[model samples]
Target chain A: MDAMYQALLAPFIDFAFMQRALAGSLLLSLASCPVGVFLMVRRMSLTGDAMAHGILPGAAAGFLLFGLQIVPMTIGGLIAGMVVALGSGAVARFTVQKEDASMAAFYLISLAVGVLIVSLRGSSVDLMHVLFGTVLALNDAALTLIGLISVVTLVALAIFWRALVAECMDPLFLRSVSKLGTPVHFIFLALVVLNLVGGFQALGTLLSVGLMMLPAAAARFWTVRVEPMCLLATAIGMSSCVSGLLLSYHFSLPSGPAIILSAGVVYLASILIGSRGVLSTRNRPSRHRTA
Target chain B: MAEACITFSDLTLGYNNHPAVHHLTGTVAKGSLTAIVGANGSGKSTLMKGIVGVLKPISGKVAVKSGNRIAYLPQQSELDRSFPARVVDLVSLGLWPRRGLLGRYRPEDCDAVSRALVAVGLAGFEKRPIDTLSGGQLQRALFARVLVQDADLILLDEPFNAIDMKTLSDLIALIKRWHQESRTILVVAHDFDLVREHFPQALLLARQPVAWGDARKTLAPENLLRARQFHEAWDETAPWCGPDDAHSHHHDGEHHHHHDHAPDAIHKGAA
Candidate 1:
């Protein structure tokens, strides 16, 4: 039992950075995994992944302007993400390009611009830091930013819960009765961007959305309702974060990839063994009901 | 005539500046049950979208009477049934207009939802996820939502498409009940026989209005033929017709008489 405690709890208790990283990641997963569930339900998981890439340049610009400060990088990342998200949507609307195509174009450009910007003034180590993240290096400001953003996201989601669900199920019906649909959609997109920005500080731009989407996709096998799916995804995300942090501490693996890989494992397990999953369905008796 | 619930003043609606339904000018009277009949791609769906404010007008205006709430059901094909939501969750969205974004739902609202579900023969389906529902049950659930919406103007786009006979009859009965409640109801449908049997008024469309009046008169065999010809005559490169051309060709349809063809001509040709 003591050995298990040493393996599980010692690193977090012994090191301040580990505790900070765990706290920040926990808060982030709590907020973002639920948002990821919304993204999955709306068929926008790929869009979420694309927008995470889009956040890189703004964060890189912030790193350039203010070194590695959390506030500047967050603000810059948010601005860049919103620009790409809104700009891609506008481009899809006005031009002949579809949303997926425009998002792909914009995110690719953002990724290229971001890597170039980061590599201009800093070493390869700095580029790695920007791309893969350093959860172990989290400070007070980073922890606070993650915590605050998580709270704000949760509150906004609660307020817009009805509108969001209504929009997803039947957008035309929502629009005809009230003018809440478009604004609610924009607000939901902004929340997604905000969560990605908050998550990027710990998980990095590329892997942050993995935390958002993977657990959401995994949760699909466990439940068939939105609220439960959200709760289950958040729980799955938290577990991955904890296990990933421990794996990174003990096995000396990269934290971001470790976390995402843990989420992937959960997703795989869900597909195989979850109550409503593929394997379970395949194995169930094909008995007809006598009505 | 009853007061106008909706007015389209030379309304033209379409995508990318290409008119799908153009040169439409009419009033749907309050408490009127009107069937919008058209051939495939004849802008029946587009007209419904324009009325519900989904597709913006290209050149004209669609105005709903002030203080009249609108409830719209797009085609079933347009809905994502795979969405993770319970029947109760979908139906409760009807309270959005009454409750706004942040208002609390009173017990009476809950009761209203329950009553609506019962009315639609889905009394015990409150907790069932919408994804688990069969097509007919899903359609019934959607109807329950519309019932809870309690709107003054209800527009149903192809509501009967792919629906089984029993479900179709149940939904039709619901529409009839809504008509009895004096709601302005516009239905987009292809079954001319159903329209003639149930709806008092109809508008036959073919990108442009071919006829609009009594169901029997508007769906006259000659009008359906003209509608078909107009649909086929659509020129991709043609510019918007001038106002003089619009006035000359457009028909208010109430005065036009075809004394020769019998009304059952629809059962023979269109139905």
Candidate 2:
């Protein structure tokens, strides 16, 4: 028991940085996994990824201008992410192209520009830090920011729960009864951007969206209702965040990928063994009953 | 005449500057049941959208009586059936017009949702995820939502297509009940015999007003044929035509030759 405790709980108990990392990631998972559930149901998981990539250039630019200050980098990322989200939406509305296509095109440009900006001034190590993140190096400000974002997200989600679900499931019906659909959609997008910005501090722009999407996707196989799916996703995310940090500490693995890979394992297992998963139902035939 | 619930004055609704519904002038009376009848893509759906304020008129006005609540059940295709929601959750959304955003779902409201589900033959199915339900069951659940909405103006677009006979009869009975309650209701229906048997009023369209009023007369064989011909003869690339140009455009041989019978070609004062 002591040995297992040493392997599982010692790092966080022994080191201040590990505690901070655990706290920061747990807060992030609390907010983002719920948002990710909505995105998965709305079939906008790719849009979430694109928005994450879209933040790269602005974060890199902030790093360029202010040399790694969280405030400047966050502001830059938020602005870039909003631009990509809103700009692609506007283009899709005005032009003949669909939102997914427009988003795809814009995110590619943003990703390329972000890489170019980072490479122009920084050494490879600096570039690595920006791209892969520094979960172990989170300071007081980063943790505070993640905590604030989590609080705001949970509150906003509580308020917007009905309208957001209605909009996602049956937009035309919502529009007919009330005029809240468009504004609610904009607010949801803003929340997504806020969470992505919060996530980038720990997971990096490239990997931040993984934390948002992977557990949510996995949760879908286990539950049939939105609330349960969201709760399950959060559980999966918290477990991954905790275990990933431990694995990183013990095995010398990069924390962000380790966390995401942990989620990947959950997703894979769910795909095989979840209630509605492939292996669970395979080779089983049941007699049909009348309603 | 009864007080007009919805007044459309030369209303032209469209997408991308191309009119899907053109130059409609009519009034749907208060406390009346009207069936919007047309061929496929003949603007039956568009007119329903316009009345519910989903589609803005490009040329004219659609004046729905002020302060009236609307409950609309669009075709099932418009809903994301795979969404992770139960029948109870969906039906409860009908309370939105009453409870609104951030309002508590009171015990009474929960009772109302339960009653609606029962009314629509879905009492025990409340906990079932919507995706697990059959299409007909989904439609019944949608109707249960409309019941919970208790709106003054209700619009149902092709609500009965592919529905079984029992579901159809149950829904028609619900519509009749709503009509008796004096709600302004419009249904888009494909079956002419059903519309004639149930609805008192009808509006026929072939991207323009073909006829309006008296279901039996409006859906007469001659009128349906005209709607079909007008729908088939449409030029997909034709530009938007104003009221003045619409008459002449139908006469212009370069666009289409069959519409030259000018007197029969226009229903200038028919509604």
Candidate 3:
């Protein structure tokens, strides 16, 4: 027992980097998991995925200009994400193309452009760092950025909670009563962009949305209500971060991928054993009966 | 005469500059209960969209009485039924115009939501997720939300589709109560029998005004025939004609106007 405890706890307790990685991951999860729930319920999960990939080119551009500075990369990621979101939306609106098709086209182009830019000036090591993230090497500046973004995301979400839900449920009804429809939608997208930007530094552009969407999708199997689902998703996200960090510390695994794989494991477990999960039918009352 | 709550002056409503409803002129009096009856593609929903400011008129004017709050119940297909929201929370959104975006919900607001749920026979369903409710029950829940809204003008678009008869009569009673309160209510309905029995005024439309007045007169068999015929005669290949040119389609003799603009003639030389 003592050997197991020491192996599991010592690295986090002794190494400051592991502690920072855990804290940074927790903060990112806390802010973004609820946004993920909204995205899932709004059927924008793919949109979230597209936005995550869309941030890569911007972050890569920032990397090309400023190496690996946190602020420039964050700003670059934010601009790229917003441009993709708004651009795809505009393309869908003006042309016959659907939103998902437009988003797919934009994100594929963004990923290619981002990779080309990184390869143009930087080496394979820099490309791996940007694409896969360096969770264990988070500095104080990165920690502060994550903390600041978490606070802002939570605050904005609280203020716009009612409008966001209403907009998602019945936009036409909302439009008839009030004029907050468009503003709420844009603000919600901005929140998604901000969280993606924050998550990019810690989880990398490719896997950042995993910290959001995986826990959210997992939480859906546990509860039907919005508030509980959000709370459960947050808890699931935090747990995944801690467990993934410890696993990466013990084994020689990549931190970001380990964290996402941890979330994936939880999601798979939830799908099998959660209250409303597929394998939980024995515990659940039958949904159909003879008339 | 009662004051006009809504005045449509040659309003042309459409999509991509192609008018679905053209040269519409009428008035919905304050405290009137009016039914807008039309065939499937005859622009009933489009006109409602115009009135609610969701769609702009292609030309002319739709002058709603200023400062009068509007409540609209669109088709169930338009709602995101899978959204995760409790009946109480969804109903409380009716207070949006009053509370704006971030106002606190007082105890009275809670009481109002409860009262509305009771009014719609959904008192105990406050905690139920909207997705769990039956079709009739969902319509009832939406009506509860509209009750909480307390708007002066209420527009209902096909509010009775797929609902049970019990729910239908109950909703109609609520509509009557709103009518008694002197609110202007406009419903887009397919059932002419229901309109004649309940609605005092009617606007029978088929891309244009077939008749608008007393339900008994406006919903006569002759007018209903005209509406159906007009809808059937609509030129799918008609060139994109603006509101100015649409006037030529409606001649003084209704019979002649219907026969003159054959589908082929409508498609040719209107650009």
* Model 2, runs deviating above 4 Å: A283-291, B231-240, B243-271
Question: Which ranges of candidate 3 are over 4 A from the true structure?
Answer: A1-9, A93-96, A282-291, B231-271
- For A212-266, candidate 3 gives per-residue lDDT tens digits of 9999999999886788999999999999998899888888888898999999999
In order, what fnat does every candidate score? 0.74, 0.84, 0.82
lDDT by residue (tens digit), candidate 2, B60-122 = 788899977889888645688899988898888889999988899899999999999989999
lDDT of 3 by residue, B90-119 (tens): 898888977878899899999999999999
Winner of 2 and 3 under lDDT? 2
Residue-level lDDT of model 1, residues B1-271, one tens digit each, is 4778887777888876667887776677899998999888889889888888877898778899998988888884456778887899888988877998889999999999999999999999999988889988988988898899899999998999888999899999999999999999999999999999999888888887777778998898988888887644456788766666555544444324221222222112111
lDDT of 3: 0.85
Q: What DockQ does predicted model 1 obtain? A: 0.59
Best by DockQ: 2
CAPRI docking class of candidate 3: medium
Ranking by DockQ: 2, 3, 1
All candidates: TM-score of chain A: 0.95, 0.96, 0.92
Q: What is the TM-score of each candidate against the true structure?
A: 0.91, 0.92, 0.92
Across all models, the iRMS values in order are 1.6, 1.0, 1.3
The models' CA-based lDDT, in order, is 0.86, 0.86, 0.85
